[model samples]
Target: MPDPVLLVLDTAPSPRLGRLTGRVDVRHADASSLAGLLPAADVLLVWDAASDAVRAAWPGPGRRPGWVHTAGVRVDRVLCPELAASDTVLTNARGVFERPVAEYVAGLVLAFAKDLPGAPELRGRARHREVQQVAGARAVVVGAGPVGREITRLLHGLGVRVALVGRTARRTIHGAADLDRLAARADWVIAAVPLTDATRGMFDRRFFGLLQPSARFISVGPVACVVRSGLQDALERRWFAGAALDVSEGEPPGPDGPSRDVPGLLLSPYPSGATVGWRDRLGEQFVALYEQWARGEPLPNVVDKERGYVPSADLPGGAGPDPGTGPRVNGSAAPPG
Candidate 1:
């Protein structure tokens, strides 16, 4: 029997798939060539998780891959109506990012509290300013997923009170309804939810207005979840103390972008989850999942195409079980690919 064709949507440093060389026939494609190569592929590995090629090409393809996996946690970039409605199973790099991103959020909380971003400037100007304390601060971490849970755990270790909000209320996890009330009193409000119909533009003027004037905002989620203009206006008007965004809607604005001059605003080009050796880790993760698929066993991190995320049963007083293991799969059996 011919080896299952594994098509990779290539990126700068391609995933090292040497382990699969003998077991799979691997092919590479870019945005332009992706559609042409989709038909024969038994499995599609979206190595360039940031690209929208899958969304654009998936709808125009012949037979789509039996299983499609993205190396990123958020599947919105690759999800489209066609793929979502098909029998093809979709999965993401869920376990790989939780810890790194949570650590990044913790760092941002500390940086904001200590005003670390302004320290160099203060030294250069011979000026002094007082900074807030992180311990005893209150935080509202939206999204009850692994990343959010990790953030909550890290913040608690720092002596900060954290309110973890999810789609619905459960033991120790607040529901979406409590977000407004919680944000109003929080010292730090973090957006960690995935981008879905319900979450897109969730952080708008009203939500920003709900924050305390001295509070800080941090978003490690997709850029679309926050309204850029609303955040800009809020910062300019001092509605909140400050904000740090790791993701941007498009090509992040250049140095002269409109938000550049906005005081108390910091922007990073989506690097929260991208620690050193992240790509290699993602490669290893996909390889492991592929092996599971080859054995016709249940694949972990299988995304619910309709909902756009991996659904998990809520655990009492927590975000759920170990995310590295993730939710169990039931009917995702398929021939070795």
Candidate 2:
């Protein structure tokens, strides 16, 4: 029997797969070549998590890979109707990013609370101003998956009172039903949910309007969850104290992009989950999962295609299934939950 073909959607500084040598027939493809190669492969590895090539080419005529895996936590880039409805199993790199993203959120919370961004200006003017304390502050963290749980744990250590919200109300976690109420009273509102049909544009005008004016909003999840214009309006109108985002809608916004002019807004190019050696970690993770698949064992991090994320129930410390907020695409409208 021929070795099963493993097709890699290539990216710069490609994943080191030396260990798989002589065990499988490895192939490579760029966006332009992926469709032509899909029919011949038994497994697909999406190395470039940010590329939309998978979604674009997945529907083409072919017998798709039996299994597909992305090196990113979120599956939005690779999801399409055809793939979702197909029999292929989808997996993601989940565990690798949880701790890094949680730590990044903790750092952002501290920075905002202590007014760390203003330190340079204060030094220049030789002025002194009191900063807020993170202790005793109230926070509503949306998402109950591994990433969300990690954020909740770290925030608890900082003495912050965190309301961890999941899809449904559980023993210690709040449900999507309580989001508005919790957010309205929170000192910080953090979005950590995946991008799904329900959460795509959940943080829009109405949602922002529910926040306390002194509260700060931070998104560590898919950027499409936020409506750019809605957030800009809220910041301009002082509906909230400030906001920070780790991800951007498409490419990182340019210097002249609309986000640049938005007051009290901080933007980073989706680095929350990217610690040093993250790529290597991703590569190593894929190899491990691939081995499991080859042995016919159940693979972890299997994404719930219809829901667009790995169900929290499948993860250690997962709060539960995440019932998303509302259904809306980016910049569109959805009825209030």
Candidate 2: residue pairs that collide: 167-323
Expressed as tens digits, the lDDT of each residue in 202-321 for candidate 1 is 999999999999999998888778888999999999999999887533336664333566789887755778889988999899989999999999888888777778765532234333
- Per-candidate Cα RMSD to the true structure, in Å, reads 5.7, 5.8
lDDT of 1: 0.80
**By TM-score, who's the top model here?**
2
- Backbone clashes for every candidate come to 0, 1
Off by over 4 Å in 2: 59-62, 124-126, 248-250, 255-258, 318-337
Give all candidates' CA lDDT scores.
0.80, 0.81
| Tens digit per residue, CA lDDT, model 2, 23-51 | 98999999999988988999999888888
